[model samples]
Target: MFCKAFRVKSHTALKSSDRKKLRGDISSTFPSLTTEKLAELMPPKEDLTIAKVFVHKGDAVSIYVHNRNPIIFELARNFYPTVYTLWRHPDLLPVFTTWPPVFERMSGGADLMLPGILMSSFGLPEVQQGTLCAITLVGNRAPVAIGVATMSTKDMLASGMKGKGFNILHTYKDQLWAYGDESCPPNIPPEEIEVAPSANLEEGYLDSESPAYITELENLHLEEVSATVQQESGEIKLSTETFQEEKAEIPYVENCNTSLQETMDDLLHQCFFHALKYKVKKSDLPLLTSAFLRNFLFACCPEGQQVDIKKSSYKKLSKFLQAMQQRNILQVKELSKGVESIVEIQWKHPDVISFVAPETVLPLETCETSDGGRKQPYQPPEILSLYGINAKMLPLFQASGHRKGDLLTANDVRSVIITYVKTNELVHSDNKNFVTVDPVICDCLLNASEKHDLLLLKWDDLVTRCLERMQPSHRVAFPGSSPVVRKGNIEAIDISVAQRGSNKKVTIIKNLELYGLDPVSVGSLLQQRVQASFSCTVLPGTKDRVQVQIQGNQVSQTGKLLLEHFKIPRKYINGLDLAGKAGKKK
Candidate 1:
């Protein structure tokens, strides 16, 4: 169901009470989960977000995201586990195993057909219709898909294991999984992978064209049955260790001399040079080391390939880049204490000059820098602090046809007062700037001193007093959402420098959630930009609001990130002057 992209309706941090309720709900729903296991899934200290989304078919789904991965989602009040959640606890639900090749079809939104299932001698797990279940590959225990049973085990066997088995909702490579870190399924070994029974010779089973395929499957099933029968009769014996080792054999390089580590190092260097030759441009210089690796180097990798630095001899991107620097391929500079950048590149260097550009390069989009191009993240609507019409200002607003509780900007307030004066013909004929103060205006917009003596007021004075008499409020309107009016002033993004321990200084930022900036994402971006260590902590007396703490004084960088990257107005951000003299001001 989640194969296509979905629209996010609302993303908000789940309240503590709601979180507790959800935990209880999940515990009751999945009774096998213990208190400790549930705590691990939904950590108390971590931020849990409940995102309301509309799928392609306009079905509303409430997804609970933890650590950027959607663990659970609710559709029609029915909770379903995500593939991410099933990975850790594979046996949480009744599992059905299928051939590896069937996953490609399932990822494309196809249902799990009985023909595709690898039936074991023990038969399928007994499940009622609409019971949530997990699907795993033939040899791997890690679940790659989740769905509800379309029929019970009795019905499935009664029908000779034909027709649909499970209605696949979310799959490994679907849009739901893309919402996460996009980590591949782990290679978890299955306890007992079985072959399908050959009794039901359904036509077009597994889309097989040749009879040999069906014959081979039946032979495999028979072989297993024969072996089991022989073992029971003491006619043959099998070594458990050898059998497990064969089943768990990971496909590595056939050559014994070459290690996987060496292969990874070669792959990293190949990708690095490929990026330099075909991807990296001169404008991209002064690129952050982290960005260079994540954006440029990784994008240059061939399709279906990945570079794992941990497996390489260099072990780190910095070490790999340092080795490249030694080879005169690029100049790595530590512009800041920990932050490193590729300030210059040797385009004419022997290695770069001799590198051949591939005819077909992966069409991967890299993030645009401020100079290279504009790559903006999803920014929330600009917050506007305005006046809300209260009971005191209701009389004046009513004269202009504005109801109470109507939020108005300064210009809006002035316009309303002017409209009221003109409609009442209270403007002085001699001087248009002066307005005859009516009883309603006198009561709502005037103080005791001004009301007792002054009958006529200047237009500006009338407007100013009208604003002062109104209650303070703010409005926030996210895209595709209605404007929300809240009481009191909006909290500003607060940045301050505090001394940690004796000598260490740290920059602390808070109130980011109010502005739609995720503290975790912001801190990660800041860490990459400044090459500093950072941490996110939930603020006390707040509804799961996070505060970002970074090493050293990062007032300048933090301000720039909010101003440039997030496009937040300076008025909404505090501590600009605290950024020191070198900080950019606008």
Candidate 2:
């Protein structure tokens, strides 16, 4: 089962001799399979060199076709050796039939009950007690579960179809099924069959063409049948046809429109009601507001959609809960002036009880796109050779076997320092956190002011000084593009203060695209964080580069937001010094 851990005991390559023996075993186990069919399923000898056979501790043997694609898993110790993939293959559907309601349960590792079986007019297939059989859903002929029959068809009929009929070994979505490529069972239309006979008839009795005699015999059996038998098997008989009819009768609910034409209030309301009726449980009521929203409300959101309170019409979870309370859908309890918790839920509210959640189509964010296409995968920013090691920083790299003028990335600089300290035994013996600095290190790496402070320095300070010394030699080198010709140039984020009118000042930020952030989202988030008016405007000279302009002196707040939240490096942000100087000027 996927819910539990499955451990693989050993993995080995099958030798030529081993392959020959395995083929013999397979042939004997599956007599119906032809040599050509086996070859088509498995790779050739050349590809077999990379193939690995994994033996799981549970006595399951998995053979990977070309070391990557898991083709088959066999139960070596079963009486009639079982292969899990046979159920998945379309060519092997005539084996069995299972009820549709138990499909989800069987996939989740439940045994198949006799009542879940859909007996044809001819009755259950004749098989031995331990014979391996494939179990398929009612409407779909393709097998979705694999199991061994627990009792013979005759024994099952004598005892009545009430107990566990099959001991399921493996099913769809189980751990073994997840080994190979991800796949779903193929869809097949249900086959129509005559109603099952009321009384047990001899095998081949249904094949007889004497319609008048068969009808007369059926009427006599129905008259002799007791009410107890009808009462006992009534539900099982109805489940076969009534369940499917009910599902077919339910109308398909259309997906709600999430485009800009739909207001945020309407979208939130639709999603909230859907979550209340379908997702939230009565057992989880009387929960803290924060926990309820984070665990229940947010988790109930459709895939690819994120819940942001700021995006809601109410702009806060508390306000939204209050509105729901007013509508008699929920009741909230306040712990303090601003803190609240959900106390009770009106589960039977007319709007919630009757609402049917529709299938999710597109996320709200993607619905606003002009083309209505799914959002593309995120591509990380291009790697750049920002700096070359100078003479002052040469020894640090030289100690780590790198020469002067060698291009060093941010990661390389940290590695060189760590290597030099470990090699020179410069770390303080008592406290490994502190590194002992010598004159050679001080002259080349440390600042003139920091040198006099102490010979001993923290690990962070040493790294900071090393980077500051190497900053002057910075050069931009975009990966997958032309090499850098010019040196000592680095892309810096532009931040500036402007006098709008009178005494008011606006802080403008640009070059955010270089860090791979959408300008619109950044502007909206900034507006919410600072409680200030913010707008995104396309810069004049650039193609699509936009700048975020927030009201008032928000330069410092903008810097902190970028550094703490977006994780942009501090060195890249320019004009932060102007924020403090402007304050001082006033």
Best by TM-score: 1
Question: Which residue window of length 10 is worst by lDDT in model 1?
Answer: 226-235
Model 1 alpha-carbon miss at residue 586, Å: 29
Candidate 1 residue spans exceeding 4 A from truth: 1-96, 99-117, 120-135, 138-180, 186-197, 201-314, 331-344, 347-377, 382-386, 428-432, 580-586
lDDT of 1 by residue, 1-586 (tens): 8877665555667889999999999999999999998998999997887877778788999999986689999998878889889888888999887654456567766777775665665667889998988988655678889888988989987876656778889988787887665666766665743444544333323322223444575555433432110122211222223333443353311113455577778778888898888888998888889888766786666543457786689988899889989888899999889999999998888888798856544522122222212233354575777999888878887767789778889888878777788888999999988999889988887778888888899988877777777889998875544778788889899999999898999999998867766665577566655667676665777645778888889898898778865678888989877774655834
Q: Would you list the C-alpha lDDT of every candidate in the order shown?
A: 0.73, 0.59
For model 2, what is the C-alpha lDDT against the true structure? 0.59
Q: Which residue runs of candidate 2 sit more than 4 Å off their true CA positions? A: 1-13, 43-69, 76-94, 187-586
TM value for model 1: 0.56
The best candidate by lDDT is 1
For residue 506, model 2's alpha carbon misses the true position, in angstroms, by 59
What does each candidate score in C-alpha RMSD?
13.0, 22.4
